[model samples]
Target: MTAPGGNMPRREALPAEPNPHAQQLAEQLRALKDHGELSMRQLAARTGYSQKSWERYLGGSSLPPRAAVAALARIRGADPVRLLALHEVAAGTWNNSRTSTPAPAPSPSPAEAPESAASPESAASPESAASPESAESDVLVASGTSAAGAGIGPAAGRSLRIALGAGAVALVLAVSSTVLLALRLDAHEDGPAVASPVPAAVTTSAPAPVYTCRIQRVDGLWYAGISRTPDAEVAYGSTGPGVAEAQCLLRRAGISPGGIDGMFGPLTQRAVKALQKRSGLVPDGMVGPLTWKALRG
Candidate 1:
């Protein structure tokens, strides 16, 4: 089947750290679409969103907006409140993950800087050598004064240590966040789950009934006739041979009517509506003359 928009590029692959909440919501959306037996285009038509948008949402390539989620839930007869809650959670998580601060670059230590511009060779020149004793006395006095000034008070030293510890803690947190993001991505990649196909029939102890109808054309119109009239309207909740005939025609048109038990249920109605929409007729969930003709093809 063609994607909703013509010749659009495929969506990018899902990120490594896909938001778990978003993945859950996407899975639920897929399940609902499968239950409804809807194609992307059909879903788009019903939900007023593009088929491409639905594809991205269902594929987990992007988190759908709240309005889109609600629309899809309504179409699939699901609980909008629950789905929207999931959306909100996923949206918040995704946003937070995206907004994490980048780790700071490591700063150079004080020892890495140059101590002084003067070299030992320049200091040991003849003129300096002549006053070596005086120079040595001056150096001793400066060293003693420097040592006294460099001695930090106990309280100041303790505060400095506390500040350093806090910086270390902050650095650790930043590193941990990065690692966690990576692990989340890895987990998501490892557990790729595809949605299971929708069951053709609901579980029941009783065997399902089979239906058959004869197709014929008369007066340039086609019909799947099980009755003398051959043009009877079959709608939801309608039963008997005519319903069976409509179901048969629907099956022939490549649309499933849930099962051919001769009962017009929701599945049958949806099939009729889909066929009507495809044939450019009013999709009122009723199998009228135009729908019958289209299905008979």
Candidate 2:
């Protein structure tokens, strides 16, 4: 689902107020002057003013004129409201000094001014880049100092450049990883879409059934009988003429005939017994001439 802002989603509302110290007004002006390598007198002349007046304002001795403030603000690219506040402070201090009457001379202390702040060298120059916040100070100095002292002055620019490079590399890696992950997810989501069924191609062909005959002995041989009782069947010594044909015929009647070789083995006898049982004849394994002739007939 999407919001009603056409194809674009509506953004959340932002806080109405902006920060008062967004540009750190005083700091920016100082940095700009330092970076431009200009003295207050030179800056004033560039914008049109006397050196003494420039000193009074920059030295924190007197409030700056509105024209001078506007000029400095323009050069520094700072908000006028914050710069105006600094002017007010300088004016108030100047007023207090002029109003105080000389009373007592009892307070002639040596520590009235900071030793570092009062020194001629310090008065003519600035502090070392190590004081205050090292990172911010280094940034200011790097942007202001020449290539020689850029160890402190050029630190901020270098760090920012390095940070931007690292961010670009990280963004590229993130985009590549996201694309690869999406491709893998899509492959999984649309798992194997092609399928085919196997076809049955079985071929079956049966052979013609063959028949064989048999006759043999178990303990003692008996006559192969038409009756189911083996005890009632008669015995015979030799198979008569046409016995080979009769054996082949008996083989067809589901009896083993020992390969139709005119003699019977135990295999033939066992087959005869199995046949007797199936035909309701005697199970005693035997085959006489009568049974043979009957099988042939």
The TM-score, computed over Cα atoms with residue i paired to residue i, of candidate 2 is: 0.24
| Candidate 1 whole-model C-alpha lDDT, 0 to 1 | 0.64
Model 2: which ten-residue window has the lowest total lDDT? 5-14
Candidate 1 per-residue lDDT, tens place, 1-297, comes to 244433222333444554888888887887787677777767766655555557777878766656567777877777888887888799678655544532222222555323211445334444333332224324434444443468844334333433443344346446856997999998787764422223423443467555566667667654566653456887888888878888877777788988777898999999988888889999999877667667665
Q: Best by TM-score, which number?
A: 1
**How displaced is residue 295 in candidate 2, in Å?**
91
Per-residue lDDT of candidate 2, residues 139-252 (tens digit)? 433444433344532434433433443344346446856997999999877765432122222223443333233343334442232222322233223343233444455566
Clashes of 1: 1
- Quote the positional error of residue 107 for candidate 1 in Å: 36
Q: In order, what lDDT does every prediction score?
A: 0.64, 0.45
**Candidate number achieving the greatest lDDT relative to the actual structure:** 1
Runs off by more than 4 Å, candidate 1 = 1-15, 101-297
